[model samples]
Target chain A: MSEIKKDLLYTESHEWLEQQDDGHWRVGITDHAQAQLGELVFVELPGEGDELSQGDACGVVESVKAASDIYAPVGGEVTAINSDLEDSPDLVNTDCYGDGWLFAINVSDESELDELMDADAYTEFVDE
Target chain B: MSEARKTPLYDAHLAAGGQMTEFAGWLLPTRYTELMTEHHAVRRHAGMFDVSHMCIVDITGAEAAAFLRRLLANNIDKLEAPGKALYSCMLNEQGGILDDLIVYWLEADYYRLVVNAATAAKDLHWLQQQSQHFAAGKLQISQRSELALIALQGPEAEAQLLHQLPSLGAQIKALKPFSVLRDDHYCIARTGYTGEDGFEIMLDAAAATTFWQSLLDAGVTPCGLGARDTLRLEAGMSLYGQDMDESVTPLQCGLGWTVAWEPSERAFNGRAALQKQRDDGVAEKVVGLVLDQRNVLRSGYQVFSADDELLGVLTSGTFSPTICKPIGRARVNRNIGNEVMVEIRGKKIPARVVKPVFVRRGQIMPGIET
Candidate 1:
């Protein structure tokens, strides 16, 4: 079974949202998502300052077998992108929830976090 | 859903934590460990592959050679010596490739053929139908479903094989490439798809599991289809369905050398069509592509001229683990220049046209920049 952190909130599409220090949010794919994708070879990141809508495709992650789109969980402006992935995309497979964080977003409405699934709910969803 | 067939080593694959996938109607391992790890294992050390899904057929009787000469594009007469093998394609009347196979002359009257699994039934039917013309010679065709195949490949492959079966070291080491040495239970051939020195061993199905375990104990890493694909791609070898099919001829698929046109009186199937195409000139040819960027190239992607005019389509492609770069084979117009564009994900990326061989024998091929 894949690792699921209890402190993070998740979207149905597998992106995990971690609340940031300045009331912003850091987002990255969950461990389950990265495991399903195998070793990642390339990652196309959304540019900083770009506006993203909830449930929209923000970027793509490609492996040797296939390519998949990464979805945004909540609508917001992109505060920062993970520039480290440009050189080492396998970081997503190594430390998915830490240095592999895809991007940070300044949410237009922080209350959208309430609509996302909690760790327990997300784990149950993936199990089924 | 219909059930997929299982090979003799299916359980072994599952025991090794392999990810199972359906390939050509059989449940096979796609990968055991990470893709790059298994790929590098074969390049640096020895790796074993369970290729029992490939079909084996035995042909015997006085007419076997005569029937094959008329049916196959390659001349079977070249296998005059026992245990010699020849790679050839079974072509249709229209000069299209039916399937590519390796035929081994086991003895004066018996020849064995290893064909693709997906096209086994079709190939058998075609062979039977063509044998009618030589009824007086009396040929017998039998499928050897009870046998299993295993391939050991890499620079260290011969040493590993000799270590596991020390008794056969002399004979195995003496066997030349495309040559086979067989006892009652095992047929060991110095033949492999990977552009590395290796042996393809065929044995009774009952001995497969035990043999696989012994090889693993002898330090041969078990590889799956993922590594096999990347290795063959890097070696510039062609995959049957991906690189060529019923609609494509060998002349266009970079296999023109496999066709033998000697003894002008000997007429083979598709000879007329191939001769016509040769006279008229082939319009499109398959060539290798190397991406200038880090993006991965995949099959069915469009290839374009430098000025954005569509040139052709990518036939087979992958991120080459051995070369640590993206490489692919594409069928483009004959007049295409050295510099071309590949449309990946709606963006045209610049690429260079070079020989398909990115690596061979654990060394990078000449003219391919690392």
Candidate 2:
């Protein structure tokens, strides 16, 4: 089972967002996402500072078995991208919840997280 | 519907966290642990694969030699030794491959043939039809679906298996490449599709489960079709339906080397056409391609020349764990230009030609022209 940090917020599509005290949120594909995708071969992350709407496609994560789109859990401005993945894409499969974190951002509205699933709820969601 | 086959290690795979999938009518593990992990394990150490779906047919009688000589494209006289196995293609009258098979010469009047499972029924039917063509002696073909097959491959395969079955280890140790030996219970062949030294063991299905468990206990990593495909492709081996089909001749599918044409009078099916192609020319050849970047290339991607001429389409493609690059095989016009591009998602990606066997021993094959 993937370690689901109780303090983080999640989307049904399997991305996790950690809210920072400065009104910004750190983003990364959940451990569940990487496990489902298998070995990561390619990643296409959105440009830094690119504005993303809620549920917008922010990037792509391709594993040997299949390719999946990474959706924004909530509206935000992409402040940073994980450039490390450009050369070491397998990080997504190896450390999906840590160094494999995809991007960070300034949240458009902190209240947007209300629609997101909490860690306990997300676990139940995946189990179903 | 007839029941789908199961490997002897099916329960063991489930226990060891392998994902099962249906392949050639058998419930086999597509991967254990993970595709890349299993792939690397085979290149680095020993990996065991359940290949029980392959059909084993025993042909016996005075006309067995002549029966095979006429039914296959390769000359059978070369298989003079008791344990020698010859890889050959069964061909149609039109020179197209019906199926590729390995024929083991066991005795003067008995031979064992291993064929693809998907084409088992058709191959058997064709063999039966050709058996009737013999006027002098009777030929008999028997299918042994009651047996299970396991392929233990990689650098450590022999040692791992030896650790499991010490008695059989001595018998298999002296087994030469492409040779087979049968004890009271198990038929062992030093043959594999992974381009590694290994054995394909065939034994009664009832004993298969125990045998598989023993190997696992001996530390042989359980592998699946995912690793098998990447391994075979890296070794430059052609898949039956992908690289060649009923409409493609072995000579045109990079398998001409398997056909024996000496003593031209040894007439085999499609011998005339193959000889003609040899004398005239082949129109196409299968070659390997390596993607320029990390982008995943897939089957059906069209190949093009520098001047934008369509050359061929990819037959199989994957991210090679050994090479750490994308590689594939394609049948292209025989004189296809050296430089070609693969059209992926409507964009032409420049690709370099490489002799297959992209990965060997957990490292990318070197000296390939890009």
Candidate 3:
């Protein structure tokens, strides 16, 4: 089973959100997402100031085997992105939860956060 | 929609941690570890693939050679000696390519052809239909279902075969590229799609697992169709269905060289149509494109001229592992220039057009650089 981080919220589309100290939400795909995609070669990150609604397609991750869209789990304005992915997309496959965080979103609507899944729920969701 | 057929190596691939995926109606591994690793193994070292899914047809009888000469686009007489091999395209009457195949003249009155798996049924029907024009009973064509195929490729392919199957050392050592060496028990061809020095071995279906295990025991990496595709793409080889199908002709797909036109009297299948098309002029042809960008240029992507005219579409495409950039083959206008733009994800990405061949024998061929 792929690792699911506790103390983090996840969407059905597989983005994991970690609440930062500044109330910004750190976003990245879960380990399960990266493993299925396999050997990522490129990632198209959303613009830093782009506004996204909950569950909107925010970016794209392409691997040798397939390509997938990255979805926003909560409504927010993009603040920062893992610029390292521009050169080393494999980080998303190797260290998805740590160094491979995709972008940080400054919250505009906190209610969308309540709809995210916790570790236990996500574990059940993925298994199904 | 029927259940996918499993080759004899199905269980073996699963045992080796292969991630299975359905391809061309066969259940096969997409990869064991990762695709690039398998690709590099074949490039820098050695890799083996379970190619039993490829359909092999055996033909024999007094009229076998005559039958093939009329059935294939290339001249079968080119296989002047026993064990000689010829690559050809089986085309329809309208000059549309049915399939690209490799036929080996094992000996007089006996020939073996390896064709794409997805087109096997239709190809067999077409072969039977075309056999009617000749002396019917004098030509016998049958599928070789009892045999399994293994492709051992790379820089070390010959060395591994010599070391592992030491008994066939003499024949394996003397086997020329595109030729085969066979006895009652084994048929080995020095051919491959990856543009690497390799051997395609055919043996009893019962022995396939044992052969695969022995190759793994010899430390040869296990590769899958995923790597097979990337390797062929980098080598500028075309996939049958993607590059050309019933809707396209060989001349339009960069396979004009495979056609033999020297012997004017030799009227092969689709000869009249191809001759007419050549006379009329081929308006579009397949060319290689290289994009120095992160995103991929997948098949079906549109090509445009610098001034924004529609040129053509990519037939086969992938992110080239050898060059770390996106490279693909597109069927575009005959007047396409050195530079073009490809519409990828709604944006026009500029690309450089070069010769259709990208790599050969594990080395990047000239003109691939952007």
How well does candidate 1 score on lDDT at residue B213? 92
Candidate 2: tens digits of C-alpha lDDT, residues B1-370 = 5777776667877998887888778888877778888887888888988888899999998888888988888877887688889999999988999999999988778999999988988988998888888854577889988898999999888888778768877777888888999878988889988877788988999999898888888788889888898898888788898888888888788898888888778888998888887888888888889876787767788999988999988988887777677788887887776679999766798888767566654556685424
Best by DockQ: 3
The numbered model that scores best in TM-score is 3
TM-score order, best first, reads 3, 1, 2
Deviation (Å) of A115 in candidate 1: 3.9
| Candidate 1 CAPRI grade | medium
Question: Clash pairs of candidate 1?
Answer: none
| TM-score winner between candidates 2 and 3 | 3
Candidate 3: list runs displaced more than 4 Å.
none
Task: Give the worst 10-residue stretch by lDDT in candidate 3 chain B.
Answer: B361-370
- Give TM per candidate: 0.97, 0.89, 0.99
State the displacement of the C-alpha of residue B238, model 1, in Å, after optimal TM-score superposition. 0.7
Q: Which stretches of candidate 1 lie over 4 Å from their true place?
A: A109-112
DockQ of each model vs. true complex: 0.71, 0.54, 0.74
State which candidate, 1 or 2, has the greater DockQ: 1
- Which is better, 2 or 3, measured by DockQ? 3
